[model samples]
Target: MAGTGRAGVWAVGSAAVAVGLIVALAVRERTAAPTDARPLVVYAAASLRPAFTRIATEYEAETGQRVELRFGASEEMLTRVRLPSAVDPGDLFAPADESYVTSADKLGLVAESRPVARMRAVLLLAPGRMPPTAWGDLASRDMRVSLANEAAAIGRLTRQRLIATGLWRELEPRVRGAATVTDSANAAKLGAVDAAIVWDAVARQYPDQRTAELPELTGIEAEVRVAVLRQSARPADAERFLRFVLDPEHGLRHFRDLGFRVVE
Candidate 1:
């Protein structure tokens, strides 16, 4: 009887030990699983590359997350994001301007949107060359003025707004002709055309490019929009990244240095 009782006691002890081992293993696995969030995909505007790159590097250092960038024109980026199978889409979309955001919002593709920075078109002229000091001067045959198309919303708006204000029309005959329109004003500047309309951000890039505010010019305050795409597998990470951009001091200064006017 005593031997049987001892055997029963051993059996119970063995079962308890087995159960404890099982719990221990589960706890180990739960604790050991990777919790570090890093490496997220980002699609941004080509024009925004300089300022955004600085913000990206800072983000990586503060957090372990890596930014895999896809940079291009805002229109191009918007089209890419619209594709049906863009499942597992980019973690973030930082378009050069907000028109893309309005379009993306209509498609229900953007998960989160925020206006982080603003900018407007400026008249760019070659360094050391005579620039039209006023809008009326553009009508002169000597002033070869260039401007970007409607696809660049601000570019298109700048023309109309300035004209509405009685500024652009003064130069419309000379500046609006086919010879004056270019895919991008930056291209015109690179081609060394006398003057072209371009974003303040872009204008700031070329040290040789001088910027002047054309009085009565249509000044559309384009906001640089940052959003999270719906296909993103990492929403939390995307939110974190968005916060990084909107952070008041550090990243904001980076944008300002690039000539982006941040909204209050």
Candidate 2:
């Protein structure tokens, strides 16, 4: 009887030890499991590349969070976010024009949006040439100009303004089409054209690039608006980044330095 009692005690002790080991192993595994640490993805317009890149770098430094930037035309960014099967959806979208945000919101892709900056069209002139004082000056026979095609946000805005002012018919014949505002600027820079119409901020990117603003091109401005996608895997983190972007001392300063007018 004594031997049987001792064996029972040992069995119970061993069982308890085995259970404890199992529990400890479970706790260890739980603690050791990897976290979801994927970098936040952002789809932004190409024109916003410079300022947004700086903003993202500052944001990453301050928060220690990674950002993946994908830059393209505003419309292209919107299309990608809208079609996840075709392209991986991004956490946020920063288009050069606010209309893209509105379209995203209509498609139920955007959770929220905020205005960042404003840009307007300007005439980028080649070196050693006089700046055109007015829109009519572009109508001169000797003046060859490059313009962004309708696909780019800047191009669409420029075309809309010219059509509204009844200058499209007169200007279209003299204009050579470029795929983007940067390309239009480059056309002028390379002397492929006498002048190119591009965003005011883009013109500032080129040092010694003479630019002339035509007062007649009123309402040709585009607002850079950022949208947080509803499908973001980390909505809270995305919102945090959005707040940082709107902070006057943070992202706004970068835009201002790049010649973009702060929206606020």
Candidate 3:
């Protein structure tokens, strides 16, 4: 009877040991699963929507990795990355201007950065309106112009250019502030304004709007840059996506198709 009891006890202990081993293996596998298996979160400037959307789709198909994209004004995206109140911090950021990346780097929020593209500011005129011959034409009382507010990269660039040319004061009264270059372009498209200053690429999106290339505005260009966030939970995966974007055949092609000047 004693020997039978010992055997029973040993069998019960072995079963428990087997169950424990199985649970330990499961936990180890769950912890060791490749972080790349999870979706990479990217906060991108609204201006990058077209190109990024396409690139992300292709990347998912090719690598079997998923991507979650959040688009807004470049500054707004930066703010979201910095605060991240109710949301998870993004793994990557692609702002329309490099300045935002510089600011993020100053805050110790950036792990790496790369230049993606470049865009020049241009005047988008409403249909049937003759392109202005000079900057002063925008200041004319008959002209109603819309410009992006200072919160947007294009808006900041527009203000800087207009100030340098000594036309900001003259043009200020005639200008209606918009939240983004896209908004300013929309105002022109809807004929809410006679003209708007927007990125050349944005102007291309509207076939009805005519782009005016002025020698004075030639110097206004923004370098679109992407950065890996230091606080990213999946840094390695984020880096892989970054490299895919920087690849000429993959991401740059889409930007070029959208009329964005692809940077080498």
Model 2 poorest ten-residue lDDT run: 29-38
User: lDDT per prediction?
Assistant: 0.74, 0.85, 0.86
Off by over 4 Å in 3: 1-37, 85-87, 139-141
Q: After superposition, how far is residue 200 of candidate 2 from its true place, in Å?
A: 0.7
Clashing pairs in 3: none
How does model 3 score by TM-score? 0.81
Q: Would you estimate the TM-scores of all the predictions? A: 0.77, 0.80, 0.81
lDDT of 1 at 68: 70
Tens-digit per-residue lDDT, 121-225, candidate 3: 898998878998887677663789889888777888778987998877888888889988889999999999998988887898998768898777778888889
Q: Mind giving the per-residue lDDT tens digits that candidate 2 earns over 132-153?
A: 8777777763689899888777
Which ranges of candidate 2 are over 4 A from the true structure?
Answer: 1-36, 85-89
| Candidate 2 residue 53 C-alpha distance from true site, Å | 2.1
